[model samples]
Target: MKITYLGTSAAEGFPAIFCNCKFCNEARALGGKNIRTRSQSLINDDMLIDFPQDTYHHFLTSNIEGDRIKHLLITHSHSDHLYPEDLVLRYGAFAHNMRQERLNIVAGGNAYDMLSKTEQHGITLLKISPFETIQLGDYRVTALPARHAIGTGALIYVIEGEKNILYAHDTGFLFDEVLEFIAEKRFSFDLISLDCTNVDIPISDEGNHMGLPNIRRLVCRLNEIGAVSASTRIVINHFSHNAAPFYDSLVEAVRSDGFIVSYDTMTIEV
Candidate 1:
């Protein structure tokens, strides 16, 4: 499977639209991977994860055939992840692709509530729950509860196909239930993308975001449970402007620790 990171920043984006901070200033000056948009990704060009407001930008910049996307897997109801209003463009009257298959949108209850209200045409909504698996084309996907924004029913996904990819973003640490579920299943992932929102924060049991320290802890825990081996590629993404280090410095710091810091338009094959 091929994974493409459409955007790699947190909700407000790196060099946020309305910020004058030094970090944002530097990001703007040193534009490249440092200029990140809201987080989102696409798998095999057909399956999409999260519909951030930057979807159009990704389509144009990445040269992707936006209409070819057949499935959308929403992680939560956050505006950065689930921009339902843009989905209206897929309606028959707006888009001229009637021959294409209907788009299947999968999400948890909270996200579903918002997506379902959108005007539908060639779209299918599937409300998902943690631990339940749904088959879309050749891939089998399962949603895991994310301990973010308490009661939001935020989710992280585990996709199984030619390669297993565990997409864990917008969550600080794995919840006990999710840990137990993975423990019981003994599933090892080929690639695991983790949230690195608090990149510079030293140590704290922060509930909604993760830093390098928390990442180290999670890696140890995953290893202890035999869920990750040396061959498992760990990807760190979903950065926030609050992360103190600049893009280059941050990459240098984390690369040696066995992580692939994702950037916009970055692609990886597994």
Candidate 2:
């Protein structure tokens, strides 16, 4: 499977929309990979993960046909992840040359509520729960509880196919149950996407986000649980401008740790 990092920033983006902090200023001045939008990704042009407010930008920049996306897996209802209103474009008359098939939107209850408000036509909302594996098209999707946002019930997803991938973000540490669930399944991820919202901060499992040091610890735990191996392509994404070391510095700091820093429009094959 091929995964495209459509946007790789945290809530306010890398440089942030209105931030003037040292990190944000550096990102703005450096440009290129330092520049980033909200977090969102596309898989093989047919499946989507998180429909951020930057979906339009991603569509235009990546040159991906919005209508071609057959399935959407939402991690949470965080504004940076799900903007249900934009989905109205898929409705007839809003877009031309769209396929007649309904877009399968698989998400949790909160996301479903938000999507239910859209006036979009070609849409089918599928509610999912933690640890429940379901077939979507040819892939088996397993929803895992995230340590972030217990009230909203955020989730991390594992997509099973010829090449398996675990898309985990907007999360901090792995819940014990989640680790057990992954261990029980005995599945190893070919690619693992993790949230690095905290960047170089010292916080670990205490916060709702993870930093570079925390990431190392988490990856070690995942390895011990047999969820990842040395061959697994690990990528860290969803960075906040408030995080330390900016982009280039942070990349260099974590490079030796075997994690690829994600940038907008970056693509990886697993």
Candidate 3:
């Protein structure tokens, strides 16, 4: 499977929308991979994870085809993850060449209310609950509970295909329940993309988000669970200028620890 990170920023984006902080200024001046948009990813150019407001920008900037996207997995109702307003443009006079297009959007209950209109716009709705496995083409996708917001129906996912991948974002550490499920299923991930919103801030057990410390702890736990191996690829993404400092230093700091810091438009083969 070819996993491409279309965008790699937190809710407000790296350098943010309106900020004059030193970090933001540094990101602006450094340019290149330092500048990031909202978080979004594409698997094999067909399966999409999270449709943010910057989806249009991602489509334009990356090699992904917007029309060929068949399955879309929404993490939550957060606007940075699920932008239903743009789904409205998929049909009617807003878009063209959609006579054979069938976009299957899968999400938790939290986003159902917001995506009700998009369901009627010629898109197939696949409502999936935590632990429920759904098949999309050749891939088996299982939704897992996230450690973030209490009732927002946030989810992390493990996609099993020719190469398995764990796309865990917008959440902190992995829950025990999810780890047990992975163990029970014997799901070993080839590539794992974790949430790194709090890049520099060290957290012992913060519930909402994760930093480098929590990520190290989580990886150690995953090692104990046998979910990850020596050959497994570990990537840290979903950064924020408020926390992550600069691209060059960030790269140097995490590279030695076996963590690949993702930048926008970076693609990984698993």
Candidate 4:
């Protein structure tokens, strides 16, 4: 499996929009890995996980063609994750000479309402629920309930093919129900991308987002359940400017744990 971290920042982005904080200033001056866009990932160059508003910029920089994307897995209705209007741009005057097949859009909750609005040509909307597994393009995708966005009943996803990936961003600590479900199914992941929105801040499991400490506890729990082991690659993604004060510090913090601190355009193979 080939995974590309197109953009690795939280909702407001690493430097954040409309902010001139010290971190933002630092990121501006650093102008390298310190800079980040919204959260998004491209898998094997065929499927996309979370279409943030930054998709247009990401596609260009990552050398991804929008028309070539066969499947799109949205985590929720949040504007940062699911930019509905752009999905509409796939057809009609906005796009032409596209691939003949439809783009399968899979999601659940209120995100369905926003997605339902974009039911145009070359777009197939498939609503999914927790624990439901469906074949999406070349992978088996399973939706798992997310602790974030209670109003939308957001989800995190597991996509399995030659390798398995647990894509969990904008999510808090693992829910007991989700953990039990994975445990019962005996699903093992080759790579686990977790939400590090709050970084080192103190946060509880019930919070809408997670910090590194919460992430560590969740990894331990997942390991105990046999879903993760020594060989599993742990990646900390979706960082916030407020949480990840500096890129070098963030990388150094997770160095001991061997967690990959994702950056824009970082590609990994499993």
Model 4 TM-score? 0.97
Task: Give a tens-digit lDDT track for model 1, residues 185-243.
Answer: 88898999999988977546557988888888998888888888899989899988888
Quantify how close model 2 is to the true structure by its C-alpha RMSD in Å: 1.3
Count clashes in each candidate, considering only residues at least 3 apart in sequence or on different chains: 0, 0, 0, 0
Q: Candidate 2: list runs displaced more than 4 Å.
A: none
Worst 10 residues of 4 by lDDT: 84-93
Q: Residue 77 of model 4: what lDDT?
A: 89
Tens digit per residue, CA lDDT, model 3, 6-119: 989988987889988888987888899899999999998789999999999999999556778888999988888988888888877977896438888899968866787554
What's the lDDT for candidate 4? 0.89
- Candidate 1's displacement at residue 263, Å, is 0.5
TM-score of each: 0.97, 0.96, 0.96, 0.97
Instruction: Please list the residue runs of candidate 3 whose C-alpha ends up more than 4 Å from where it truly belongs after superposition.
Output: 117-119
For candidate 1, the clash count comes to: 0
lDDT of each: 0.87, 0.86, 0.87, 0.89
Best by TM-score: 4
- What digit string (tens of lDDT, one per residue) describes model 2 on residues 122-147? 78888898888889887899898888
Extract clashing residue pairs from model 4: none
Query: After best superposition, candidate 4 residue 209: deviation in angstroms?
Result: 0.8
